[model samples]
Target: MLIMKPRILNGMMICGTESEMRYCDIGELHKDFHLGTNTTIDFIMDQYDSGFLLELCRRTAQIVYKDIYQQLQQGNSAVLIEHLQYYLDREGGVFDIKTVQDEISVNVSKCPMLSHITSNGETLSPNIGDFLSDFYGSWGENTPFIISVDYTYPEESYCIYIRRYYAS
Candidate 1:
């Protein structure tokens, strides 16, 4: 007889072998956090104005992208793109990335976060675009790149364009 114990290794949860093995990542944690954060923002919006929510979103973006900002400062742009792809994949996002000249475009057909929240009978913040804009904008600040996000909320899709910039 063999007894298998569940353990966490390299950010994945390992329980058994083959089919019994389960993979886990921070995506789920992020989903929960996003839900809570959105809910809090919604509650606050009732008492405050849109500026407060935008500022909160901007601050959240700053905190979340702080490490990525450091990496960009260290000249690790490839790693940043790779990390973004990996993150979207892990979160079950439907997206495609294309590179043209000095620009890279990421087209997200389906947003995993929105899907998760809606599936749970929750509504996403109407100002979600502001958060995304501030998030990528903050990450690109003082870096050698320009990041922009274009959203089509009715279809729940968006495209992020990252262009490298060089000082002349």
Candidate 2:
């Protein structure tokens, strides 16, 4: 049995064995997904308050953190920074990660979601910062690490500093 891997090539998602390959137009899918996500976010903001959105982001972060934690426990061998780098690279985000001593800094020059949202002529929610704060805050819960984020929505740029905490 041949193992099939999915890859992106020339704006197409290619998958399946070499004998028979399947191709999907990544451009169409990307546009549709971004539009749907932007619309959903707008609808959610219109229907609920910012606090509600923050809570949702927090919960999502907790879930993701738990999964990463579990993977680490199973001897995945990848560090948190590596996981973050993988996510950003896969999501089409332009970012740089640097580690110094016990601290890691992630600088995102182009936030894919935010860029897509703004490109669609949609206004960002005023509570975007609060949402991000809650998300990263919750993500570090129950861990010996913490993350701080500073972002400019208009420029779609952000800097995240991740530091290890020690209980002395």
lDDT of 2: 0.63
Best by lDDT: 1
**Cα-based TM-score, every candidate:** 0.70, 0.68
| lDDT, candidates in the order shown | 0.67, 0.63
lDDT of 1: 0.67
Give the clashing pairs for model 2. Answer: none
Top of the candidates by TM-score: 1
Q: What tens-digit string does per-residue lDDT give for candidate 2 at 1-168?
A: 334566767756665444332222222235446556556556668898767777776667656456655443343313555556655665789999887877778898887777777887877655566655666666566666777789765567788877777789
Name the regions of candidate 2 deviating beyond 4 angstroms: 1-46, 69-79
Per-residue error for 82 in candidate 2, Å, reads 3.0
Question: Given candidate 1, what's the lDDT at residue 98?
Answer: 94
- Window of ten residues with lowest summed lDDT in model 2: 19-28
